[model samples]
Target: MDGNTNEQPPAGEETPAGVRRRPWPLRRGAAPTGVRRSLRMAGVTLAVVLVSLAGVVLGVFAGGRVDTDIGPFQATLTLTPDTSGGTTVDIPPLGALLLDSHDGPTHLTVRLGALDQMRTEALIDDPASIQRASVSAVEDVRTGVMRLGLRTVASAVLATLLLAALVFRNVRRTALSGVLALVVSLGSLGAAAGTLRPQAIEEPRYEGLLVNAPAIVGDARRIANDYTRYAEQLQRLVGNVSQLYTTVSGLPVFEPAPDTTRVLHVSDMHLNPTGWSLIRTVVEQFDIDVVIDTGDITDWGSEPEASFVGSIGVLKRPYVYIRGNHDSGRTAAAVARQPNAIVLNNSTTTVAGLTIAGIGDPRFTPDKNTSPAGSGLTKPVAEQVIGAGEQLAATVRNSPRPVNIALVHDPASAGPLSGTCPLVLAGHTHARQVSMLPQQPGLGPTQLMVEGSTGGAGLRGLEGEKPTPLSMSVLYFDKDKLLQAYDDITVGGTGQAQVNLERHVIKDPQAGEPVPVTPTPTR
Candidate 1:
């Protein structure tokens, strides 16, 4: 009784002198049992998710690729994560064709590889072999895809199990991870199957050298209607390939003249991806020295549409640009920011050995909500364009250097520049026209060249029953900066794959005579 009385004080009371106080029985700062259990479960769930993600990434890296033969051609199939589900056929050193073939979290890529020479030759020479090879190619591709799916799933499951074992140190957890991986893989497969678009092969977007993919593949629907027709088409394709190879290999090395300047004239692109491809191909194939765009490079002149102008940099040639009715000041600024681009707005600049002058269109006509107040909202009137042209002519006349070429968006804007420069380029009507303006007493005549829509007038071309053709012109200049000859190039309208070129030669530039306009068809 004496010891208890000496040791004890009220629970909250402090002990005096050397007397010790017993500690409280309850443990402070400890979580409840239910909360601790919940935290443990959360940690396990997080670990499982992280392990599964790592497994999927590793599986894609290790087992996503499979090499197989598509008849005579070898190809590699690969699985890659892409929100935009599609199949891409990549032809090395050329380009790729993208098809909206399916919808899923993963993208399928079939990279065309080396061709078996013997087999290709056999298919080309024998009609029967074409049919057999076509059938075999389809079957082979099917089998290869199945094999790739199995391998990828197995790899992912194995990786998940190993990671789970290392992290959890429990067989039950590892087994659970493997099962999760399988479920995920099956779910992806099911999604792809449900959204498969077999007809997507008919509509493809081509990049780089494969921009001519539509022409090479022909109409898919017609080809699929008859096996014999399909074989015939395949035979022709092989024959064309062989012939092209032979012709190109036998041709002598080409060396363009040092004194000659080649300029590509394109206008009214209107934000067509195919138009950019065509421009790139022409720049490479024709050895173009410069690209001159009269304008309308975009539709809405919105910030989002400015990205298309980035293609100008990729052209790798001097790109002289001007704003069109549909292009706002923002669009012109975006173009000005691109590499190798020169924006002309009542200004003069020399590029690729030619002195040029250009002016922006006076009006901006964009869709509602595309531009700031008082801009890109009104249609361009004729008087406004004429005034812009008069101002540009004054600027050209006061330039420090002689302007060899003058550019404007509308033909009306080109009117005041008749005697200002030897050549005036304009595009607005979406039609091609070439004529010599009447010569002044003491000045040489000006050649007015209006280009058709390089982008087939963009989506608007398809609104009518007959789609407009995509067109451009190649101008050749001599050392004197005189236009000597030019080629008018035309690509078939929508649903057509033919190409036509017409060449015009200026017999005497100094004679103030009209250039002979002859339509020489070459396909």
Candidate 2:
């Protein structure tokens, strides 16, 4: 009432009559103008990046493959985003091999499809044809790679532009995003090309059944370092391939009768990955129903070595295994885990209409650190092996089903089982031998069959002057489940490209004397 018409109320004081106070425009839950602008820019940038990535994924999966023929082999090549830049050669059921062939942001994969049998046979018959095929293969691979690269680049650009237009919804922004994506794609490819490493072929990492790469390729470093030597090695490789085809093609055609069962007998694999390929090929080619392994599957029996047993599952046939002197309890457990694998330890199991009994060797001599003192390290005496064999014989006699085959790791262990089963299979001498034990009182005489090293004694074969031959046998059984005949298959060791197959037929199964009456060479 002091009569100051323009007088204003102090901050926090009540407003004057007839005057109104405006509320704060920036109320709760509202951000500042500068902050809002920054958030909008960030959101737009994030959207652009996400869309670009999606475009790349679409490009790779939709159109990143090319098919071509190399020599007599048909193959498909593909490019994919991967930080570990390398090349992978996939050979289907045989497994894959990875090579550090280059350095880049992408990976290259070559999947082999089929082999032209006629072309292969021609190559084998004509040495000049081999030279022509090798030259043609190189040219074909080069052209295929170029086509694949161009298609991948074009696919990426098109995909990026389409995605950018959908995301930005503006001509200017979409154009800018497309340019950015193109720049990135081209840069990545340029970087890969600039960092190529042809020498990486000297050291390839093998996977699956191709783990025998070293044995097959034969010292890649040596070949790469010397050009003249490389030429020789290449010729040898071609020769080996031709020899392999010849052997496989010459195999006797087996038309298995409905009631007849064929079993593949292998032993002393010694952890050779090539053995897997050999076994699988035989299984498919011969129509094998059951596979019997007489032990020594691994060399060290360590945890890492246990992984080799995975091949047992891949075989897709009933695998009967027993532990050898070099195999530990852990090794046995690994074999047991494989699908379709049967681990026998003083036990019996029926497979393919044949009742088989087996027992693990008592000795474990590979690694002293893992094996127990004395008994594990020392060589088992004749008495110890014979006693173990006696235990297996007792188990066979007590089985609910009549045992037709007795399996043991050592030949000595098979002695006590002479009359327990009709056929006794054993390994661990690394030599093939067949003999008929004297007739027993109650049971028929036993036919003892000992197999050699199927893996050619693994890597140890390289140490000797002459590599040991890789050996396996295919046993044919009659409809009555009686042993009839077997074909002994032997492939010459490293640097040797010879395959020898001997067919031995048993004249009389019930007779006390059984011998290889006629030994015929199939190849």
The TM-score leader among the candidates is 2
TM-score of 1: 0.52
Model 2 agreement with the true structure over 1-523: per-residue lDDT tens digits: 6899866455445565655655445768999999999999999888777777778767866777999887777789999988878888887644677888777778889888756545554553343455577689889888988888888877877888898888778887677667766776677677777888877765777776557546553565453233232223323433342243345334454333578788999998887555666677678777789999999898766654666677677779999999988787988998999889999999999998899999998777563212111233235465777778999999998989889889998887877897887899988878888888767788787899989988767655544556667789988888878787777887665445456666666668776344443333322
Cα lDDT for residue 83, candidate 1: 69
Worst 10 residues of 1 by lDDT: 368-377
* Residue-level lDDT tens digits of model 1 in 73-119: 77899987666789998876457889999998778999887666556
Model 1 lDDT, residue 453, Cα: 92
Count residue pairs with overlapping backbones in model 1.
0
Look at candidate 2 and tell me the lDDT of residue 307: 61
TM-score to native of every candidate shown: 0.52, 0.52
- Give the best candidate by lDDT: 1
lDDT of model 2 at residue 9?
A: 54
Can you list the residue pairs that collide in candidate 1? Answer: none
